[model samples]
Target: MSPIEALDFVGVALFAATGALAASRKQLDVIGFLFLAAVTGIGGGTARDLMLGVPVFWVERPAHVLACAATAVLVYFTAHLLESRYRLLLWLDAMALAAYGVFGAYKGLAVTGSATVAVVMGVLTGTLGGIIRDVVAREPSVLLRQEIYVAAAALGAATFLLLDRAGLPLWVTAGGGFAAALILRGGTIRYG
Candidate 1:
């Protein structure tokens, strides 16, 4: 698979895992986990695609749905090890945020050839899943946090764009983008 598609898969899986954790926190059953996973996995991409006037990916390719559900089931079985580890969820979300941010920026640039639009799509893909997760979980939104979130996404997106413009390989630009995001969010986790 291409780097972009692989990153998208990783982002979706990470978000789905976090969703499963949220479901466990809510004392939800397997079905609830599945629902949350689906919502968290597809919500941002769905919105992004709809806005871009493209086909919603999961609808066109059902494998994405299966991946989300399968991730939920795996997390459900392993919830015991993850209980009381919301920090892990945040870290996982951070990774998801980074991966999706890169993928989204690349996609946006591919379609529109606009760096500005790419940044917006990157941030949207990065954080929208967590927003939906919080909304569905009835928890306070991450947008309310003072620590880095959207900023990290934007930084990553911009970094990716810059690196891409420099004619770096896709893997290098994407890895740099991911590192940018993780470093920013890591500081937040450490300092906050």
Candidate 2:
């Protein structure tokens, strides 16, 4: 698979773990784990795909769904081993958010060819799933502009676009963007 596609799938699994963590926190059943995992894994990409006038990714590749389900099951069975499960969830979310931000901006550049829209799409791709997850899980939405969640995504997306425009290699741009996002979100998760 291409690097972008791999990044997307990695986000799927990591976000699935985040979803499963949420379900575990709520003391939900296996079904809840499955439901939340699938939703959180694909929610942002599905929305971005729709807006981009493309097919939803998970529909085109059922393996993504399977990955989500498997991650949920793994979390269900193994979450108790972690010292602080919520911290794991936050860190995992940061990683996935960064990867998804780069992937989304790259996809947006390929699709819309507009740096502005690409950045917006990247932000949406990174944050929409968590927003939906929080809403469904009955938690406060992170998009209340109260934190650096979306800002980190925006920074990552913008970083990618700028690097691309500067003629940097795609992988380098992706890496830079990912690091930008992870560092930004990680700082907040650690301090806030």
Candidate 3:
């Protein structure tokens, strides 16, 4: 697969895992976990597609849905194992945010050829899943927090745009964007 496609897959899996973990915390059944995972994995992309007037990626490719379902099943059976590690879920969620932010921004830029709109799309893609998950799970959404989550997404998108303008390869820009967001998010988790 292409680098961008691979990154998208990874981001989907990460988000699926976060959703599964959240469902586990809420004592959801397998079906509920799968539902949440699917929503979390594709909700942002679906929203972006709708806004951009493009076909939703997951709808075009059923593999994305399959992958999310697989992740939810895996998490459902291994919930106890995962729960034993207190911070595992949190870190995974952060990774999902970073990866999705990068991929979403890249997709937006690809579609609109505008850095500002791409950044907005990036933030939406990174945080919207969590917003949906929290609303469904009855928890306070992360976006409502004072933490630097949205700032990190914006920074990642801006970095990606700068690298793309500097003639860097797309893969390099994507990796750098994901890493920048990850570091910023990690710092936030550490300090805040």
Each model's lDDT: 0.89, 0.89, 0.86
Give the alpha carbon lDDT tens digit for every residue of 1-192 in model 1.
877788889988899988988898888999999999999998888888887778998999989999999999998888877546588788888899999888889889988899999999999988899999999899888878744899998988999999999999998999899899988987888777
Residue 31 in candidate 2, Cα distance off native in Å: 0.8
Of candidates 3 and 1, the better by TM-score: 1
Candidate 3 vs. truth: CA RMSD?
1.3
Best-to-worst ranking by TM-score: 1, 2, 3
Candidate 2 residue 73 Cα shift, in angstroms, is: 0.7
**Candidate 3 regions off by >4 Å?**
83-86
Runs in model 1 deviating more than 4 A are none
TM-score, candidate 3, is 0.95
Q: In model 2, how many backbone clashes occur?
A: 0
RMSD (Å) of each candidate, 1 decimal: 1.1, 1.2, 1.3
Q: Which runs of model 2 end up more than 4 angstroms from their true locations?
A: none
lDDT of 2 by residue, 73-155 (tens): 99999987889888898899899899899899998899989988899999999998899899999977767744699999999
Tens-digit per-residue lDDT, 64-163, candidate 3 = 9999999999999998875353366668878888888888899999999988899999999888888888898887777777457788878788888889
